[model samples]
Target: MPEVLIEAVQPGSPDTGAVAHYGDPVREQRTLEGAAGLVDRSHRGIIAIPGEDRLSWLHSLTTQHLTDLRPGEGSELLVLSPHGHVEHHAVLTDDGTTTWLDTEPGTAPALLDFLNRMRFLMRVEPADVTADWALLSLVGPEARIPGIELDPPKVAPVPGAKFASADVAPRPTTVYSTAPLPGGGWARRMAYGYDLLVPRSRVAAVADELAVPWAGIWAFEALRVAARRPRYRLETDHRTIPAEVGWTADAVHLDKGCYRGQETIARVHNLGRPPRRLVLLHLDGVSTDELPAPGTAVSTADGRDVGFVGTAVRHHELGMIALAIVKRNVGDDEQLRVGVSAAAIDIP
Candidate 1:
């Protein structure tokens, strides 16, 4: 397991945990809904693939159309085993010389090893870049900074800037090179030479300058729940497939040439259906005061197991909602009990 780091950003907020090495959970949660807030994700893995054969080498290994990725363009992708089980989900981009693979912590080393072992005679080279760069994620409506343009799943760089759009998830994400800061700071190395990430001791100063409030993991969890996005540990595992989670819509390109798991993915898409489907669950008479644990089972009235909750949250406006992977036959209007300990919930 990766080492978890937790920091307190505000004066009176409770300490929260993170898988990444740095971040202030209190401020992150608060900044999720209204203003922009930054979260330190430096602990996530980053692998740089360099050489002219970079695109071709990667395109042959993973899902998604990577051969045509422009220097500033980005996309969400998945790496799967020959049997079609997900190895990792990642956001990949190129700075012209090298392709960057940003994914969950503890995944980079294995990915790099696999690439190295498979590089028969390819002119590509893979190197870990996590330590050399800092990752700062901005959320909220106002978090949009001046020099960046929102392109949904792409972040366009301002003209004449060294910054490139860092693609994260299936949504827009940007990454800036930070080897050029005046004091050798990571933020200065960004393509735009602007400080998008702040030092741990100076996080507040950066937040104030950006006019965004600090946010916490709780708020992020709520926002992700509202959006129906799946998290790695909470909603997915080795058993999960792209079709079952709805990630196949953006993560995998059906028309792309063969890759390791192409056969299985194709078979599943054309001849087989996912055993379960992801759905939104709206709890009845539940409030923020009573938060249910993820993975709580959902059963039919007679106690037949139908599904399990993936993620749950107490939204300010929506009360309690959850994302669940239920049997395909489950009806949307069906009412089900949430495990043996929790209350009943209805599919929304």
Candidate 2:
């Protein structure tokens, strides 16, 4: 696992005595598709935004159209700088009283400060709840997964997922917000999972409640890459425009009232192409044990630096795979290389 993935799942034994992959990545992926697989994603920063104005206030600032989000609805939102660079990508869920934000690690403090500064007497109160709330993810068949369905992420190409809708009573010890994820068929890339926003005190108990074999970051990273989902740190940064990464649909509501960086998104999406495009690299026969590092240069056959690789993984099914950003002008069939190994680019 790369450092980013290692840190995400490294809480290892301390969180719930969870084993990395239950001894087999293939079995874990199989169970994830056929039975159940649990992943501890609690390393993500958790922030609680509470108040009457929370939804409306957040709506005005982010790229998502959140003003009308009812309780139990989840949306992905991005906060952009004045110059329209991607500043924050948030996985947000609301339950009427409080809206929970799951962000990249070490990002909550700064994001909290930024949100607070924007709240000048509004009824919104944002609090860093990482110490109090932890995120646990459960995925598999609807019958095998413990809780009600999690919603399929909008704009996310966890594509063509048909989620189970039969309502079930919330768990006794832990309550899960509806995610409405699809069931079965990993090849569909339909995400079927639940993010248990359990109290930090109950993370262990919730892990037990799900009662599935623990999956390491390695297995989950392949799923995210195959689904074409982009993480905040690995796939984006201060220089990213949401549209450049094809996030306008899942993360941005182009018709929503103006907010920070809307202009850049609209301009690129309507009139111009994003300077770079997101690509999935199929590494040519690189050993799984020797994955390339992030920021490793990606080049054309002639060694022209078109872009750099982002998240590189040796996927269980896809072999050595990676997510990258490259110049839009790069041909679809253009063969590229990272380090000594050759790679093929599939731009999304």
The TM-score values for the models, in the order shown, are: 0.73, 0.82
Query: Candidate 1's residue-wise lDDT over 210-314, tens digit each?
Result: 565444445666667777776554567567777788767657766566898888777777655777778777776433345456677888887888888877666
- Give the CA lDDT, 0 to 100, for residue 272 in model 2: 58
Q: Each candidate's lDDT (Cα)? A: 0.61, 0.69
Best by lDDT: 2
Runs of candidate 1 exceeding 4 Å displacement:
1-31, 154-211, 284-290, 341-348
Task: Go through the candidates in order and give the C-alpha RMSD of each one to the true structure.
Answer: 8.6, 8.1
